[model samples]
Target: MADSYMDFTSPNTQFTYTLSDNPFFQKDAQNVINTLSINQLNTLGNVSLLDIFLSKDNVVEPHIHQNATELVYCITGGAVVSLINPYTKELLNFTIAPGQVANVPQGWWHYEVANQDNTHLLAIFDAPVPEVIFGSDILRLTPANVLAHSYCLDEAKVKDTLAPITDTVIIGPPASCSKQHPNGMPMQQMMNHGGMNMAQMAPGSYQQAIQNQTYHYPYRPISGESESYNAPLDHPFHPIPFLYRRWD
Candidate 1:
């Protein structure tokens, strides 16, 4: 999938990724990644190959992939992958450091964030068919009302906090990968101050939420404009999830 804009023969092997940018993901981590994909391995199957990733911390956020099961291997350092079981409000969690793998069933909500250094991990899907939908993109790129409604946050607050979804803690901004935003601020402070309140990835949430009414928003868009025709109410158009590929 190489275009004139993205040639790999002289690829920036420093970051082995090319083509397949997304409507919601970022692609500036070329320095930290070495991603290569094999188009199709077997007999016209969905077997796509993913190269190893030097996982970064904020890359962690809750997300779901619709059509595939994923297995992740931690090559170094450590990571924490968790999920809230919909049936029980308790979180099913795991601490994955070096030389270990975590298995996540498909269609479940999950997310992974790296530790202090350049933690490495390899992701292998059951069918080499996997789609990554970053949380920042989903929250920032989707219609404003949809973003707020999906997470049950006040619409005003969503706007005040999200400037076309600035570099989120999920993935560091352009300058560097540190505990701070390239925009200038500490990440823990950002999340603690509410960068990502609904951020939880316990891949194990295919079960329905318990009837507590304490968790999860009602996910309802005020009856109007079908959520498709409504424009960004007079704002500079920010191309969303321009970070990576999205199947949504």
Candidate 2:
């Protein structure tokens, strides 16, 4: 009856039991079951393991997982995950089917919009506390004055968006959930975040198709003191070359 067992005592405590002891772990968990306590899961870095049998009408709103990468595996049903990278103005959307996987990068805003009917889904993450940097948790958990002073946003604005600050739970009342960016961070404004994407990249910008010359410089000693000049790869020094090019 128990494929695996975990005791979810709270947000940071747990006891673990495994079924097959398989390192890769098991997929298609609907036929079997396993559970882990919250404390045991705190050691889990950026992830939520879901065994969901979605009904005819199920919905997960637009949200971002803070400080973690999202890897969702569709077990019995497929889903449409939406993502927008504002800085680059690039968008990568998906409608993955059963047995397929979707990867969402860390700290970038994203959401998964499921199908119209029932489906089974499994979500994996790269963190133990999945919403450590999530918008809702940030808006709901921390003290407004502390966050406002740190972020440099107006305390009144922070208060309006993340009202009634308290520790946010993964599964909690919908009323407490806050917006992804209360100021409404639309895709067009993504450029402000400095996020990278294809649209923002100029064509052939990094292509090695053209040849370019690089210069290395030799530094003169300060009378008797030796010094080393360490330069970065993207740019180099060439003051000496210019000084002597017209000397002869």
Candidate 3:
């Protein structure tokens, strides 16, 4: 059956959208995400996407898409898409380079980490609007006393540990974070010494490290000029119309 809700003859019917103009979250010039949903394009049917750009060691952060299943496609550079399998109770990691892809089941906990500079990923969803529950929100919003009581831990320590997380961290560690590697080792150097397996640690280890506020992943410094670009948001919805030129 055709889409009965959509008015095909209406002048307001939109068929094209520029994802670059819409910024969903921007950690920095190197780390940013733009989103597109049915709201942007009225004719869309249960489809949405996020245009993600990241530098080395930058993470998309652990999150659950309760409303959609995600298919992550790598466009440039490389990334590690990690997800937790609720059935097997295993943390699975998939390293994808250009032309590779990873699929995350709906409601599964997952995250993506850029393994190289200029990593570009497109996260396509099966929902019109992907709803997310960020791990940072879970950690920060939950009552500290309740968490301490449930886990049999110190309440003050729990509160103190989570104090720094004042808002939803879509991408982390946040730009305000000042934590650095004690040994001053570059991420590439560390990976070379021990391989990428070192970064694929268990979730508990990550949680403990976060609680201690010492889990800062080292990134190789960008040599020469940085090619980071942030699209201006002042006029995101107003895209210039493209005119097709006839070949002579």
Compose the digit string of candidate 2's lDDT tens values, residues 141-230: 345666677789788766654443232222211221221233455322232244323223334331211112112223232233334334
Top lDDT model:
3
RMSD of 2: 21.3
For candidate 3, the 10 contiguous residues with the lowest summed lDDT are: 239-248
Better of 1 and 3 by TM-score: 3
* Model 1 residue 92 CA deviation in Å: 3.3
TM-score of each: 0.54, 0.40, 0.73
Report clashes for each candidate as comma-separated counts.
13, 23, 0
Task: List, residue by residue over 1-248, the lDDT tens digit for candidate 1.
Answer: 22233344553423333433311233344314333333322221343334444345444456655566767788776766665556666555666888898877776667665654667666666553455545555555555665666789787766655543433333333223234444565453444333433223122121121111111111212222243434453234522322333222
Off by more than 4 A, model 3: 176-180, 183-248
C-alpha lDDT of all candidate models, in order: 0.47, 0.42, 0.69
User: Which candidate comes out best when scored by TM-score?
Assistant: 3
How much is the lDDT of residue 16 in candidate 2?
49
Ranking by TM-score: 3, 1, 2
